[model samples]
Target chain A: MNNSASTSNGSTLHEIVRAEISRRITTGMYKPGDAITSIARLAEEFGVSSITVKRALSDLQSTGLLTSIPGKGIYVKDRFRLVCELDVGMSALGNIRSLGFQPKVQRISVTKERIEDVTLSVFNPPDRLLLCVRKVIYADEVPIVYESSFVPTNMSDKIVDEFGKRFIIDALKRYKVAVKEMSFIIDAAPASQEAQRVFSVPNSYPTLRRLYNLKTSAPTMSIVGIIESPFDRLACSVRPGSGRISKMNKKK
Target chain B: MNNSASTSNGSTLHEIVRAEISRRITTGMYKPGDAITSIARLAEEFGVSSITVKRALSDLQSTGLLTSIPGKGIYVKDRFRLVCELDVGMSALGNIRSLGFQPKVQRISVTKERIEDVTLSVFNPPDRLLLCVRKVIYADEVPIVYESSFVPTNMSDKIVDEFGKRFIIDALKRYKVAVKEMSFIIDAAPASQEAQRVFSVPNSYPTLRRLYNLKTSAPTMSIVGIIESPFDRLACSVRPGSGRISKMNKKK
Candidate 1:
């Protein structure tokens, strides 16, 4: 064995073994989807028992770098990347497609209600009625995002017609309503009862909540949406490089 | 209790109650830190039992919109915004400060080890030795982020000196190392045992993992950092409408 794989003193044998394998995966020696050496082979190579090798592999798998298929052998997981940003300009449909998933939109309900005092602030002349659209977005047959959007009453009919019409972005674009600005707040919170029902998770399940306001050039800039995802199944991410500026600075 | 707060027909009484309170908070009727009406008052106003009002408030609290003290009444939570983007040019210290937290750094350990294979691909001329620095970063006495950074052997000394010197960005800047590019992959993963120990979360707890490769203009672009945060406390967000472009598209 090379000096790099040599065990460091004072640490557990299994940790060194795990670290060695982890290094291999992160260093690109074990490419994604590549089968790793068998437990028997690794144990022999590392001069450890099969149990020790198993433990090491299990540790690696827990962190999501390696996956062991039953009956089959272990392989590096496919490198999965999720980037969350406003500038993508892609509709939810496009986003799912890019991730190799067929997205299915299940409209939960549509209701008209009198506007709350705070919600009215998003509108120019703050109207009385609002249309609330609730949807569950599924990717690859798994519900991934639960979205609740509140739009002004005036825009309800057009939006309802475009409900399943591909992406919400496309729907807005069809009406020549360009989303000029958006304000977003992202935080982690316990899943609500409705979220638990939608996601099949227990109460207090950690979930990411993204509250956003989409504004247009028109005087009434009044569309707000709340997107929620169970933290176990999904993540929201952003990469700042590649000519992208920080949106925090752009806040008016 | 005007028409705006009228209950939709189908939802449960508690749900309608929750929605009413949620709307009031979001619409600025109940500003952050403002106490809402008492449970008895709300119960009487909504013509529901006190248990129903309590349930509604509890639901809103679970979603992080409200807070309840032991003796004090329920009040809205402080407005918080965390914008995760690349161009802020602020160090971790600055970031925490911006969020009104007193940041503390707890250096876990630093070790020198032989390099792994896939990690080597991130560097120009992959070196053999690596210096891994692990730190537990706290905000207002709460552990918020666990950061493990791997630096190349040549830069270890200066980088180590920069450790806990405010933020890693500031330390790199002091060495005149300009991070020109960064590639990051964000995903949800079970908290490893070490992560659980570090963050005080349960085993297999959902956590957000951000694995990043940072490249400087210098020939050696060899620092990679993995940052993890408990799913219930911290979130990474991106705002797209600013001049910033999407980093996902810029990948080579």
Candidate 2:
């Protein structure tokens, strides 16, 4: 009937039907592959319309918890067993390695240049200097991450000359600068045309954007931004217990 | 010409062009808002086909680094400036709140049920007992997350009867079972027909799936799997600070 009022309170006949089936599946009352009660049957049991029951089933299907075959009943889908957390440390690298992922750097450009206010704010250099590097990192040669990073220019005058270097971190090591603290922010937005080519996604696809700060002590050393396609194709994992990086708080 | 190769590492002329532009962006040679080199100019400079240059520009656009306008050529897109992290704690709630999101839960069903092998493996109940709750949480009254959670049956007898009575965490607290640890796994897949209706997403839209493990003293208290629509709509932030839950590890 009028499901409008229930919308505000988060109660609806569709939700009721969906919840019933979900409870059965989670508690083992209805095992996977078990044929669920038909919409007609649920409509009668709940004393609601069949449309409501159908709506409820639809809610469960969207979450990937259920699958329906035309002319057949609904069933539960396979579930992933592992737990993953996104972090940046040796442990994070280890987790990726464990997943059998090979990280490859497709260097796009390396140049030394004057810092701008926006870039300077992220990588707070002591003087008017900065180095910028852009690359697309692939997992198993499948481009997944596009990154743009900025470093203090004065820290390494040789950065521009050393264009096409393999890894920026390795270059930093050559300059005897250790990365200490990092700040990160993540958001979602529509993919750009270039992103589509690298990730092989459609023009309208959405990507996860991650901006992070690389720091030595309290002052920021570098600012890096990465755009990941389709959001879920990339899984980041961090281990607990070893090779820990020193931590520092963000500047106010 | 003839850039195709059997192996995945084969570099096409388009890829090379993409690499060149990416390098310029990362090096600060082409700052944000700057007009990217024209397709004709790049094609001539690289001595490659215009098709190759076009493909490279399209790739960069999909990566969220470039924007193209009709008859106006391509330009660098504005970049966001926030340090993003994978948030696993209450900080996640804070981030969600900062977005002005209001969460509303609708109980789909509440039931007590027997344990089976599949449910046992996912939840890891302590004594063959379990209580199941199925819910759909909305943001701004829009259906976004669908969750099916399983709890120890004996831990909270008559849980199903408690429907529409209290908040989920509050009800669990009544059982003297505090959530000590949580684990999560995220993935992406195409949404189902049912999801299309609840989320108002068109068919074939990609969604994110998150699996959560709630525990007390290393024993599983509950297991929840959430299927979310417009998966990229919500931003995720993780803070790696000193906490009991922080001690847990993530595997990709």
Candidate 3:
């Protein structure tokens, strides 16, 4: 059983204002950690009453996009915008840098497993065993992405051995294993138990889950990456179109 | 306050098994509306015990990926995979068609308003009065997308007058209004009251929201499209890459 907040004509107006403010945040007009104009001033600018602006800002606060500090006024929270396109090959190290935050590998480990790793076998490993590389990438001090990528041992002996020590993307490039194909599945779901424990969020907190399947040209290998990030810690965004964007008709 | 179902030693194995099954559904190994083998069969195939398979299938069922019929058997639900590429600009019509479903415009209307439409003005319409084109696209019988796109009247008189009568993409093409640039924002948020009411889903049900901003040449107009779709009704998927995928380092 659930109840939606009362939505009438006034709510429609409230939504319009809230959506407008949200658009500014998403478009980077309100940069992370920037102060926002007072509600009364915003009211005058939008030509709406102060109540509308207050409601709009209040909604933003609830969504973790804006923060109202005690006596310090309101400011945009750093909802660190993450790359919407999953093809950021070396992004595990680059995403945080572009956002002006120090990147750190909070945790890293590698394990080799057999059929016991039914999950990794989806990569269709030719051999019965595969290598599992897990890493936790952080933005500044906060954990952002919890990733577990898999590669069949036969795909490349170098990748199986060096991925844990070196950047996984660098290992691929160094060994001349070119990724020819990739696919992504993006969804919004409750954070996994492991993510909840790692990120220390409440149970069932919403997360942006991205799974990528990569294919290599040499030795014909299959690699899989599973990335889970909480909504509060990441935002997926596209740059304002710089050039003509061909119609994106991606078949599932 | 919430409690995570106790995740113990067996839980990790359960997740691995569940994840592999999830990968299959997402990759279309099990297409929408396909029957799945019995839990016993899946257990044998994965070389796991029946209890592990049972828990994995139960988790998938709860997630709406697989559904069980009392007397019949488990089958894949119609997750209706939609385009992950929010640039599906015109795919409001094409997406369903590509999925082998008939698409119908459930509702179509146009309106012109001033500053009250702050949400529309994010497009930065040149005129005080902007044209808002709103439509609901349906796949077969279920409403899949609710879209509201705006165009400043001064940019294109034809668009303001004729968009309601013709396919929007066609109107843009016929008028030679080429989109020079575009950007997208994709996120998962609780279903809006409008979406919940329209889609007949629960309050706060998870929904995929995609907002797009389009820029055109010539008169230099700004266009914006806001789309809200329920997760149960639509999914964002990328096809297995056919050609090499360029590094997707999209700057927000």
Candidate 2 lDDT by residue in tens digits, B41-113: 8888777889788877875664546667769878876553222233222122233344466656677776666
> What's the C-alpha lDDT at position B137 in model 2?
57
**TM-score winner, 1 or 3:** 3
Q: Candidate 1: list runs displaced more than 4 Å.
A: A1-86, A113-129, A164-166, A241-252, B1-86, B113-129, B188-190, B204-209, B241-252
Question: Per-residue lDDT for A48 in model 2?
Answer: 87
Kindly list the per-residue Cα lDDT of model 3 for residues B1-252, writing each as its tens digit.
012332233346667677777777877888878888888787877777888887777667645577676578778877554553434545556667766877777446677755343333434545566677776777787777777677775655656555554435556766777777775665666666667567654333456666667778876777776777766666565442333244433434
Q: In candidate 3 chain B, what residue range of length 10 has the lowest lDDT sum?
A: B1-10
TM-score of chain A of each: 0.57, 0.47, 0.58
Specify the poorest-scoring 10-residue window by lDDT in model 3 chain A: A1-10
- The best candidate by lDDT is 1
- Candidate that would win on TM-score: 3
Give the candidate order by descending lDDT: 1, 3, 2
Q: CA lDDT of B96 in candidate 2?
A: 36
| DockQ scores of all models, one per candidate | 0.21, 0.09, 0.24
Models ranked on TM-score: 3, 1, 2
- lDDT tens digits, residues A1-252, model 3? 012332234356667677777777778988888988878777887777898788678656645577776577788877544543444534556666765888777546677765343333334545556677877777787787787777776555556566654445556766777777766665666566678677755333456666667778876777776777766676455442332244443434
